[model samples]
Target: MNLKKHYLITMIAILILFFSIFSILTKLFLNKGFLSIEKKYKDTQINIIQTLLENEKYSLSNIVLENSYWNEIYNAVENKNIDWINNNLVYYFSSQYDYDFIKILDKDKTPIINYSKYDIDLNINKIDIINSTFKNSQQYTDLVNIDSNFYIISSSPIFDGLGNKAPSGYMIIADRIDTSKLENLIKKIYNFESLTFLSNKNIYFNIKYSTYIPLKNNNNETLGFIKIIPKKDNIKDYFYKIHIIFLIIFFIMLLIFIYFMNRIFETINSKIKSTVHQIDLISKGNYNIKLNSNTNIEEFDMLSNSVNNLSKTIKEKIDENNKNYIEIIEAIMVSLEVKDSYTVGHSHRVANYSKKIAKKLNLKNIREIEVAALIHDIGKLGIPESILNKPERLTDDEFDIIKTHPEKGYKILEKISYMDNIKHIVRFHHERIDGKGYPLGFKGNDIPLESKIIAVADAFDAMTSDRCYRSKFNIDQAVDILNENKGSQFDPTIVDCFIEVLNEDMEFKKSFAL
Candidate 1:
């Protein structure tokens, strides 16, 4: 991965982490908050039940304090108008006080008035408060209905208040709270936003359809659970929309990553191309080429400047080397010309032409060709002037003496300490690739590359320039002869290489005209 890509990825990863943590915290907080509200509502219901019970107690006690009302009913009991008394009392109390029924019973707990007329001889022993009211003549108390609707029965004994144990009769007041009204009130209070349930015994109810927040009292125990089942609310839609938005954000980040990666590769590639071009110029002896300093980067700038400085130093060294090489070649050539004047400028022209040939052949050892061409005739001093200066074609014996120059030059040059590897050219320059022209008659592949190059240079210069007795051939005709004799008098590759350089639009062609 790229450093810039790594940085961007890390940023995205941290952002996701932050969001993940934020969402988790938000859920936890919502859960705790909902539970707190549930506990509050449960407390409110408990308080409502307690207040209603207290109000019931207050109204029941007031009925016991009103003595004259029950005293008038007892007078009707004495009149033996039992039907009138039962109908009148039932109609008065049931219609006025929301009582379920009003009943008047005899001393043996036989009902003299059964308001609804369900049973007259009903056993009321399960009514604890009613038993207390009949036995101890208490004024008002509650009782349970043993064989009736779930009801609250408030009873008062028909007492004379004379501290007597006997009571004339009892006043039974009963009422039943409506179950439908209770259900409607609970649903209204805790509405559609939440699922609310109330259970006295171990019953449970679920109201909503999404997330569930369990109900609890103040003790923090889950009394019942309310489920908000997975459904579509505005909040749910909002979070789902957010998720899609972030997914697109992540995808966009990936595309941006690829963009930066490609940019880095292209930038490095351009820098490499610039470096290669500069190196090619340096190879062509263009040392004046300087690298740009303002590349807008550090490492490439350093590398460019370093190469320019190195090429600059190498050029300076090569200039000094050329000076020494020229002086040495000129001195040796002048001395050889003193003995055989025909070979005076032959070495210099060959050295000059050989450099261009080596370049056209893509040869790396050009210095070897220059050195060999300049000193090729240095060994002609050992040959007799009769054969070297002969005006006509030499006899085989005299020609054999002239051919010894390559080996003689090798032996002489091998003694010079600074010319290491150039001795091969001097010794083998006369050796042909086809073993047709040489002091030793060495064959193809037995020739050194440098020697082959020098042989082509020596032959080309000799043909194009005036010799001791032969007139010079034109450059084009000389080129044709060299090409035609490839693989016989010359190494075919070097002969072709030399001709190609001679035909170039270079300074030599323009300076040296036929």
Candidate 2:
């Protein structure tokens, strides 16, 4: 699933599980509390009953225990024609127990005494409770339902000084047991804002419980269930606080994971860039550059492998062609040299000088300088091999034809796309800064740097090397000639670069031999 849905389902399921467990635990706790309250209620009732009994209130206990006491007392009262009995025993029971109503009855079921919150009566139907009591005892308890109100009637027969514990009428005390002492006890059990609503299946708990209190019965026996619910609004805010805590933790962990993933990807990308740069260089014929691929990464290994393979083929092809192309240039230059071996390595010398001066000038860019030096003498292609090999001076027509070689060579390499830049160098190598050189006769900075490089190299080699027409100048003569013509025939800017190269006494130091 998508991330949102995935997190949504997982978190929702977790929340649901959490709430379910919370609800179950809440129910378990409340049930224990309800049970405890029930037991407490029962215990309190038992305590009250036990206390009254211990205080010699057996008259009331006997009423609760006997059945025929009501009728015996009612009959005795009726026969005596008493309005109300003057016994201190039932009155004491009433005073001690908070009984709202108290009464006595004769054997004929007449009321001996009766008292209410505001009234008194001398008659009651003891026959209504005639046979309900503990066996053979003149005591009884009858549940009376009147006007939809429920009350308990406890009746007991009186006794005389004689050893006969026979029935002698009865006394009754009525008290309301709807007191809310049980609820007060529950309040004590719950936390400050907690409560309960009784229902069949659902319970709500307001607090994460500090303790659980089960209900109790009137006999001090335990009841196992209690319902707890919140009575205030702060509980939801508690969960909100919890959500904030969990959310912060989750995002922090997520950010950490993302950061590590980014670091790993960055490392991978860096490695890939190195591989691409190496492959790109090899593609463009820069075999001298190293792969340095490290060979551990698979793509790097592949790139390194590809470059090595390509270098093998390129090395073979370049090896195959190098002798042929160099021989052709050498053969042509040799025609000049054969006419006058004073220019034995003239082409080679010019190429070296061009490259050196370019390097010294900080025009150290490789490809352009290479192509420029390689074809700097390409214009001589049109020079007649016979006269170029001539040992003596040429006619004016032949000299004009000789000067036309630069323009002619420009046209020769002009159509070859890879060699197009070579033509400019070929065309301007003979041009002079004094506006006196043939072909374009371009002056100063108007000459391209490539052309200027070839110009310096070509002039230096020509002056130092002997020709069929004249003796070669010495190194100092060549240097003086160049210095004298620095701004007039050669660009002084490139001249400085040329001076540095000559001072280096580079690889092609020997002058052309005649």
Candidate 3:
């Protein structure tokens, strides 16, 4: 991806990371805090209900104790007055106290008075259970389950009103915790959404934060559960709304920040591209071109100024080097002319002929061929003057010495940096098309094309020029010699181009006239 896309993606990633961390924090601390508050509130409400239930049990125990301590209750039990109990006692207990069941038992645990509003089982077995339950404590006030219904049952020993004698009987009173009572208690506590009594299943909780209150009997056996679901908390809803608003504001802020950052980076990117374009021009040797200096960024402005200075310095150095290179070539040519005056005309005419042949052949490096031809015999400086100026045919040993000139020329030109391109041409000019006649016998196609062109030019110039040994051959004889030597001594294509140059260009042909 490009820098802009990468930067945008990175910014978006950071934004997402920030929100993720915020969400985790909310879950860990804030949401947990709300949950903790809800738990405490539910615990408080459950405690209130539990306290009210305990108070109801205490009130029931007080009523049982007061009734059992009365002298009339003791006389009624002792005299066996069922009619008196029915007329007075039942009306007082049931009408005033809202008692669900009333039972009077003698000291021997035989029931005397048994009155119930809902036909509750007052059987012998149940009576035995109630007696057994209060035999140890002598008093009972607690919840009990009868026929799958919950009730508050209270029991006390009956005695005389004045001086308490041995207890003559026991009095028991119970108040049922029916649906209306539970509903009234809940309505007094808080406005709840719903109330449900659950069975033995342990998993009773549902959505909307329901509170499960288990109802157990005096024996601690679970009878049922009361589930209270309160209305949703307005404060919690308010907190959630605030957090949503904050998230929206944060998102808007992030977008605005990214937009400004994108604008800034766009300016920087434009400046960078401008700077790179100028540097590219400099790399391609457009030394005269200047970098844009008006980029407002300080670093880019400084870089532009530095590159401009560097370009000026490089262009000056290159111009100075070119001037020194021309002087070096002139000095080498003067030295070669001093060594052998005949080579002055011979090298110049050979360079002229090589240029014409290169142009006729449509070769790109015509100047390179001319340079190699001019320096093709520079290695003759290493040859003895006696060998170079010999009037007669050279013996085998002397011909071997003459053949070393091409290698010597390459070695001399290799030291000049600008002349490195033409050094190979100078070294391989004498190599034949068939891999013969060279210091290193490079064959056709292996020889540089500039070297082939110079080879044909050098031969034509040498054959047409007068030497100390013999008079020079005419132009036609030189051309015939080139045709005969094609593919063996001279490259056939270069020979043909040279012959074509001779036929077409009168100036080049006049230079080869005897």
Q: Rate the local accuracy (lDDT) of all candidates.
A: 0.59, 0.52, 0.71
Provide the clash count, candidate 2: 65
Clashes of each: 5, 65, 0
lDDT of 2 by residue, 5-39 (tens): 78656655654454455334433443443344334
Q: In order, what is each prediction's RMSD in angstroms? A: 56.7, 55.9, 52.1
Model 3 spans with C-alpha error above 4 angstroms: 1-12, 127-129, 133-137, 199-209, 234-253, 256-514
Model 3, residue 10: C-alpha shift (Å): 4.6
User: Which candidate do you rate higher for TM-score, 1 or 2?
Assistant: 2
Residue ranges of candidate 1 with Cα displaced over 4 Å: 1-322, 510-512
Indicate which candidate wins on lDDT.
3
lDDT string, candidate 3, 317-388, tens digits = 455444544444555666668767579778888888888887887888787788778878877766656567
lDDT of 1 by residue, 206-270 (tens): 43333344333223444443333333432334334444543454454345434554455456456
Report the poorest 10 consecutive residues by lDDT, candidate 3.
Answer: 26-35
